[model samples]
Target: MVDTNRITGAAKDIGGKIQGAVGDLTGSKHDSVEGRLREAGGQAENLYGQAKDTVRHAADEAYHYAEDFYEQGGHSLRRGTREVSRQVAEYPLASLVVAGLVGFGLGLLVNASRD
Candidate 1:
């Protein structure tokens, strides 16, 4: 989306240029200086709008990237869960032994932490 500031600034810059040109032709130093100052201000405003646009675009890209990463991670986790379930179903005894060992190891870790 184009920033409103950019459009207004461009219009202001054009008006300033016209004013300055007219001032020069009519020999009005005050008008010339004021016009030039206005032009400079317009240019600054335009730059600010451009900066805002750049930052917004960058943020949008980052958000999309994170969303994609999260979706991919979820799929991987589901696949891993299915694979583990299949393995356990195919070897119930081995799975049971492994689960008991894991529980025992966790108990030791918890005791160590308490100490």
Candidate 2:
């Protein structure tokens, strides 16, 4: 996942350094200043590339985490449904009573909210 910008930026930075060195040895102020500017630009590009890589990595991790969560939630919901079905089948009368009570409680809550 290494970015091309990082590679090119590093190469450019190295070239700038060499240029600056040569300019200094030859006593050319213009070349030296220009080399410094190029070096700065290269460093900036490298930093930008690094930032992009960090963001991409985070996005990938988040996607995988969400996918795993969805799968686990689906499995748990299916398991819960099976358990509830078994319990209701085993105690039909009790299940009916409980369902009625829940409905009544919900109705009461709704009526109270309206008031």
Candidate 3:
């Protein structure tokens, strides 16, 4: 994305240079000083635009990274669920026993916490 401030700042800088040159030709110190100040302001605006672009780019990269990470995580979770489903279908009795054991363990943990 192009920054408008950068373009505006560049135009301002060019205008300042021309103004300063004209001031010099006419021997006007005040106009020359004003032109230099305008140039400095333009440079500052350009720098601000650059900084904003850098931050925006960084944010975009981070958002893409997070999006990719979440997509991968979701894929892994789906794969894991499918694997567990296949395993339970292959060994229903074993799966039931494992579930019972897990429930009993959780109950024990809960009771212990109450004490």
Candidate 4:
């Protein structure tokens, strides 16, 4: 969840930079090619890590929204049932109507808050 690949990618990138710097300082062609290759590989890895992070974030957001919506629906159902039971025991038609209205408003509020 913490994106280990991204961390690894970053380390690779830094290592590549250091290697490239060292190769340049030492004037070694072999080291220079190796360094360039490593740098390219690291850049690719960093791009991949960024894509992965984006996907993970989107998925997490979707999951949270679904969970919140489900919980809100469940709570609304429970409250509605309780209100109906109370209304039935207290006042017949009036309480029923009022309870329904209140429950509806609460449901709307929950939905709005999710948005």
Candidate 2, 19-111: lDDT as tens digits: 888889999998888888788888888898899899999999999999999999999999999999999999999999999999999999999
Give candidate 4 misplaced runs (Cα > 4 Å). Answer: 79-115
Where in model 3 is the C-alpha error above 4 Å?
A: none
The residue-by-residue lDDT of candidate 3 on 3-36, one tens digit each, is 7888888778877887788889999998888888
RMSD of each: 1.0, 1.2, 1.6, 9.2
Whole-model alpha-carbon lDDT for candidate 4: 0.86
Candidates 2 and 4 compared: the better one by lDDT is 2
State candidate 3's TM-score: 0.87
lDDT tens per residue, model 1, 1-115: 9898888888888878888888899999988888898888888888988999999999999999999999999999999999999999999999999999999999999999999
TM-score of each: 0.94, 0.92, 0.87, 0.61
* Per-candidate total of colliding backbone pairs: 0, 0, 0, 0
Q: Flag the better candidate by lDDT, 1 or 2.
A: 1
- Report every candidate's CA lDDT: 0.91, 0.91, 0.89, 0.86
Clashing pairs in 2: none
